[model samples]
Target: MSQDPGLWTVLLAMIAGAIRVSTPFLFVSLGECLTEKSGRINLGLEGTLIFGAMSAYATAYTTGSPWLGVLVAGFAGLSLGVLHGLLCNLPRINDVAVGIALMLFGTGLAFFFGKPFIQPAAPRLPGIPLGDWTGNPAIASALDINPLFFVGAGLALVMAWGFKTTRWGLIVRMVGDSAAAARAMGYSLGQVRLICTALGGFLSGIGGSFLSLSYPGSWNEGLSSGQGLIAVALVIFARWNPLRCFVAALLFGGAGALGPALQSIGISQGYYLFNAAPYILTLLIMIASVSPKRSLKDAPSELSITR
Candidate 1:
């Protein structure tokens, strides 16, 4: 605990903001977790994320129901993932190249649909009352945590357990690690990747829903601002562990908020540098996680790229 009231207040606010802000990253990272664990990388998650945000905003605006928007966004994400998976399945195509192409396509589609969504105000998400114990307005604002935050945390817990304990989890991991082994055991690797890719897309789509329907309550070209890319980075930092995703997301969120936090205190140094927080974190984590030795030894033998 800090003796300074203002510093303590800022710290508390950061904690609450981290929870609210990490929701989208949590969902998107979890989605990537599935895709990566199944021996594929969806670089198109960036595009998928934007398209999902646009789709969710548009659906919610049109239907007057936030839940429907979320489902529709998920389906849109699924469609994009399926397309990417199908393309990656082609013999001459590379998964990374396919991802790049899908990223362009997904973003283009989002901008197109986002035309009408810029002005629409869909139903905003209801946040949890985290400061009901205090009657002060500052406390309430500082403690307003989003429901998506808790949902994301719960999903992380579920995914971690699912990966370590379930039959489906075992099969996915096996297929990713070694297609030859999976084939020897009479498993279909392509099918496994397809399922995981679709699931990943679904989760990414839900992440988009969190952005447009909750944070901004509107859609635009800049709504995401590279959150999709950040999510991809978060997955690696998590070491493929879902629980760690939540913590990593919060860490990144705090980094993302550092600029704003400083401006509030009238000390705005290194503002531009703050803008690079997520990217810097991503690069550092990637460098740390990837290696010539560990990658060669620990990466899935059947993975087409890492090898």
Candidate 2:
């Protein structure tokens, strides 16, 4: 019946870490979900995520307002999304190629503009102490939830609802499932996709805000850690469902937290392996989720055609 304080502490750290780390994944995966639902793949989101991180950090440093930084990040994401959409519309242009190019472009731009703000202090996002009632410092620390986390959660609900009940969602679904059907119904395929891509990028930009303003709380050249690309795989693992994306984000977050949680308890033997847990888990999930039938059952027809 003896209680192991170290185990409890590690658990608390992981719980808190999961909540903190999952925010960006939630936002980016949701954004990618929307983009793919519109039958377009935006690999450029990796670049957008980095750009948003730099933009948010720099804006917060300059303006002394984290919220303003968040807003600007969203605008940056929108701009990038629009650019991707526009470029993809050109005849014979591939979205994946455009996305890779944009990824480099956005990262380069962020690094160029972000150099000066690297060491500057930026405003931090507010957090709600949900663990205050627990009377345990570890628990309290773990439960300090960011407002943006709630925002992303709310967005997931709205997205799920919209996909099931809203007209706009219907239009997006139609465009994704059948470009021919959409065209027959007078919907412009390019326009619908452009709007979805922009909106998706906007959300992704918000995800970037969470990274620089909340967790690591700094502007740096190597901030993103490939979260955007991972989100693409995350969307696939979630089977294109918004709610599933939310849950999957948390799962990935927990995996990411495993390393530090172990290290806190002095488990240094496999530190790198623990750090790599998230990527390994992502790979496993992708492997498990792949259909042996050679058909992504829930994938949009337009996306298949584009690929």
Candidate 3:
């Protein structure tokens, strides 16, 4: 059977868009999932994402190596994550508050340092053509997957396994579930949380790298568009499951792609509303995930917001 040209084009665009847009979401959600698994939340990842984008673009422009740019972005994110961890560890400090401050700081730094790179070109990440054998340009283009996507998928699988079997994963889960128990077991709460937060930041940075080096393939002020914040909500929706987080990120990516896909098919009316699909999806997901009778069943017990 054959499909209408417009419908086929829209479907193809959405498929491609879902893959392209999901990269950042996947990485950020994974990072958030890891941090939450250790009983910490970093809302400042929005900053991390922006900063990573700037850092990656700048480094790629200077070094002519997109991979190097990705690496530097991760380091930049690690720095922010470390700062957040240190601040939150201080007596009477709140994680949420520190995260907000860091978010602002990261965004400011990105804007300041990113000014010169605004007009410069950077190396882009290489993509793999998964649908090469199909002999269809649209299919080939839609399947032109970047390496980072595979990395994110592998990480999700590994995380799912590690959480159930690895010693460190068990420790992280224990720490997140009950601080008192983790403390009783001779674990340092601050240390664990700090490491996880930094790791989360690093992953988020890579997500940012995917932005500047891959899709949209440029450095800009509005690069992130709240993907980082949505990641936190995604973690909640995923119930802190790494595999589920991957699926949730794709769902969001697909939602984000809807507007562009519709436009590609000449559906111009309500274009702005279509563009707001991701945010709307986020709100709806949050609402559906919540319950008045009790807390989310899978939330980490030691998370301050949940308690």
Candidate 4:
């Protein structure tokens, strides 16, 4: 066996892994944030994420353009989101139940169609060589960042600013906070939710594209590993703030990197256990953040969980 790396190497690897692993979380959380802010919850994002991955990989393999794959994935997600929105808009429909059914439906579709592409090679998204100047191979490799990471970060900033300043942002907030008020103000509640949910699905799809086209760089049924579902909890932990969602994503990414970082330094005995860190952290965060007495102050009044 090869010798173990030094402490510095482990830390550097963890940092790199955090940046890499967090991209999907960031995108998914942002998507969920947008959806919930519009007074709707989408548990179906798990299906959307996996289906997006399959579609992106298949499209990239066929078209020989990873960017096109990304675009297609977003549309795939939008289609599912639209379905969800339309179903939920029906009289007396429950958003949560509809979302769950869609999640299973989406996953089934991805699994059925994705089997063919599992063994084929697909073009992957290119990364920025940020560490080229470092003069160290390992450091350089670690710093080779993906462009989508930057895009996600920029999106978070835009969302944060838009929520407090833009007209669309105010409308979403109004619709989410009080449906009756939104109706009184001449806004259509169903329309706002449908639009936001579709947009959220688009973002989630892009995040899935990153998974298949950038990091793992492959098509597989198990690619998502529940990141889509976990993002819902992440949104709650973030208090629905886009800026805080970004930070929360990074934190979860760091937790996820812990196992691999240790393994890189020859600590592989409990590797699988270490990999469970993210889920454990999620549980802890939810426990600490949730309360039975008082509701979250920043939670939308019309949100189902909050009620």
Candidate 5:
């Protein structure tokens, strides 16, 4: 920490960047939170992320409106989510395999369409002022401060409340915890999973859109480097709670931004090592979440992936 700058400065930068960078994770993880809570996994979000980025970029460029691009990206992601749901409903189509296939398909599709736009920049998401507390320009400069960051925060609050107080959240949780129990209650597993999967895809696609059309503001082959997978990992770190997801996204976001922040302050500090922060932290969280035997006992009983 000292090699880069003052600890507080680094911390400040991390907090700010975390808000911006973590928006994608917040969106994707929260969506996965919903999917996993429904006793299903959509590893295909990795693909959705890339596809959404490409779709969003193309739409925003063609129409000259980034917001529209975001919408298109969500719909594109929903299509994949629906496909995953439909396939998973089939007798022998494993969800994991479908997810991997989607990842390849989405990435390939993104690359094919993204090649032309690689050199162009799209309009970015609008930003709101929340840094009035500081008189220093450095603080403001360190954080891009996008509107979606706050949207993500607000979303967490809404989702957390909904899960606790709404009938749908309860039913989804029930379905995830015990399929037999959910079936006993006359709930259609296929319907619930499909709806939830589509919703998840929509959210994940928006997350991907945020990366290309907002924070990063450009398209390239390396635009996203495993953020989708890290977000899936974030689901476990967050313990299936939307509120925890907000915090965890910021934490991972901070880790991800550390390298860039250091570089901004004239510190390289083994860029490769710092770049691994998000992945390393994710692995640690997975180990902790899985190591505790009691967590499983407390987890949704029908979650086969965790079991």
Candidate 6:
């Protein structure tokens, strides 16, 4: 009773899926890249992401403004980032441990507060009609684009340039490379790390907003699906370069879109397994990137994962 989609249709569907799925990955990896550049890590971004989704949905539902929801989500993430930074700065504090704790705390808080708003519908973000001129319903639907993807792409370019040309970029790299050297240059280690981590959280929060406001476009406990944690590996896969992070996110997004793409062409026997592609790719990347002989060439010297 149904006609099969052509090869081109399937390819187009995957491309669309990649564009839609990669936005969150792009934002999260960039956030991690910035935080790690300043010699800190925020594992708690997972929690920040979930909480941001809930808050964004709640705000959009209440105020009838999706943009306002996105803003609130970023600030919510910033607050969590600040908390993680402060706790990590205490004497004998371990960044990894602090991050894990904050992750749990943030997740718990989000679930507790996000209950009532679960059933309510929120205003969703609008999509750009990139394929409207095609005049084909399937093609147009496949090419419907979200504005956040462009924002994430633009931010990646700006971040890459900023790291190379800005004064603050110099400080973040200095601190990441050698805390002693940064101190000698009159930079406060805690201050630099704190600021970068907070900004990272802000970006990640915005990424989370994209999930609830766009793709799945709804808020639920299972909305994140561990994307926040996967993004940490994504940052490493990118080797701390903002531009590389962008590419890596697209790669991961493509892998994630594989199953649905196949399903679109009537290949459904291994659909669930196909969905595991991203995780498999993450594991492979970790294996390839790590070496017993030497650390990653571009890894921050002061980064705990490297040291």
TM-score of each: 0.93, 0.96, 0.96, 0.97, 0.92, 0.97
lDDT by residue (tens digit), candidate 2, 1-307: 2349888878888888888888899999999899999999999888999999988988888899999999999999999999999988898888888889999999999999999998888989989999999898777877889999889999999999999999999999999998889999999999999999999899999899989999977888888899999998888888889999999999899999998988887888989998898889878877776663433778887884334
Task: Give, for candidate 1, the lowest lDDT window spanning 10 residues.
Answer: 292-301
lDDT of 4 by residue, 107-137 (tens): 9999999999999999999999999998999
Q: Give the range of the ten consecutive residues with the poorest summed lDDT in model 3.
A: 288-297
> For model 3, how does the per-residue alpha-carbon lDDT over 221-257 read when each residue is reduced to its tens digit?
9989998899888888888899998898888989999
Q: What lDDT tens digits, residue by residue, belong to model 6 across residues 1-307?
A: 2443467867898899999989999998999999999988889889989988988999999999999999999999999999988988899998999989988998898899999988999999998998989899988888889899999999999999999999989999999999999999899999999999999999989999999999889999999999999999998878889999999999999999999999888789989999999999988887886783333678888988777
What ranking of all candidate models by lDDT puts the best one first?
4, 3, 6, 2, 5, 1
Whole-model lDDT per candidate: 0.82, 0.89, 0.92, 0.92, 0.85, 0.90
Candidate 4 is scored at a TM of 0.97
Error (Å) of candidate 2 at residue 287 is 3.0
Better of 2 and 5 by lDDT: 2
- Residue ranges of candidate 5 with Cα displaced over 4 Å: 1-8, 132-136, 292-297
Clashes of each: 0, 0, 0, 0, 0, 0
Using lDDT as the yardstick, the better of models 2 and 6 is: 6
Q: How many backbone clashes does candidate 5 have?
A: 0
Model 6's alpha-carbon lDDT is 0.90
Residues 33-142 of candidate 5 have per-residue lDDT tens digits of: 88888888888888899889889998998889999999999999999999888988898677788888888888898898889988777777776656656876776565
Q: List model 1 lDDT by residue over 44-155, tens digit each.
A: 9989999999998898888888889889999999999999888887777788888888988999999987897787678876777778789987778767777778888898
Q: Which residue ranges in model 6 land beyond 4 Å of their true spot?
A: 1-5, 292-295
